[model samples]
Target: MMDARHDHPKLVLPPPTYPAVLFVMAWVLDQHLIPPFIDSVSSAPLLGAILVILGLGAAGWAVLRFMRAGTHVEPHKPTLAMVMDGPFRFSRNPIYASFFALFAGVGMIMKLEWTIVFLPILWLCLRLWVIAPEEAFLSSRFGSEYEHYRQKVRRWL
Candidate 1:
């Protein structure tokens, strides 16, 4: 049998770091280079608040599930178990989904148009650099179980 730790996912960086860097860049652009997309949208803050709450809740839940499963939450570390409960039941990448939600929510609340604009780019980077490699590792390590989970759960929802 292969050592799962030795076969951990080859990731560019910690997954959260991608969104953090993108968010900072977006905030800087919004403050200095670009103006708010809307002069004032009364609903933006409310919507942002809702998204932020949901995102944090989902992320926390996923982390707890990881802990219960005794699996390494960090992508670069070895995965000891396949978590299928909690938010994982809905989306394979719930934590990542939460990150996007949190990023967009903060942007909306702050009226940062650049942050919204960078969303697609942020998603593409995550997909290519983070999720893809992780998926490959999971498929290799978990085999059919991971494939079945992948088929059942959408990448993002």
Candidate 2:
């Protein structure tokens, strides 16, 4: 029988402890903090609901465009090229931005104020854990070309 073990170092598991902490915090706030705040402004009319739906649709479209841009290249692997055109021109991390928009829009539509709290947390996590490391890897890989694209594009719009 062939052995499965390899000589190469295994990939380090990024600590998801923080996300769990944030999830707990969100739950607590949802139970306590948001309800009272929402009581004052929970009545979103039909037009407002429609607008939220449209915004979510737009965000979904952006996500699809980002996926189809052939920029991802590798799944769960750092991007090889700095994708600066298409939706990326507006937001360097359109996939992450789409997630933010989708979550925020749903929160607004549902009057679940606590869900909006996840938006910034998600952005911060992506910035610290995902974007920064990816930036370092790409900068090292592509050098000046990547830097030029970074200079032109905002990290998030």
User: Can you write out model 1's per-residue Cα lDDT over 1-157, one digit (the tens) per residue?
Assistant: 6675566898878888888899899888878886776556888878888989999999999999999999889877777889999999889999999988898888888887776788898899899999999999889889999999999999998
Q: How many residue pairs clash in each candidate?
A: 0, 0
In order of appearance, the predictions have TM-scores of 0.94, 0.63
* Top lDDT hit: 1
Model 1 scores worst on lDDT over the 10 consecutive residues at: 1-10
Residue 78, candidate 1: Cα error in Å is 1.7
Candidate 2 clashing pairs?
none
Error of 1 at 29 (Å): 0.9
Residue range 71-123, candidate 2, lDDT tens digits: 44332443433556667677666655655555555555556566556767866
Off by over 4 Å in 1: none
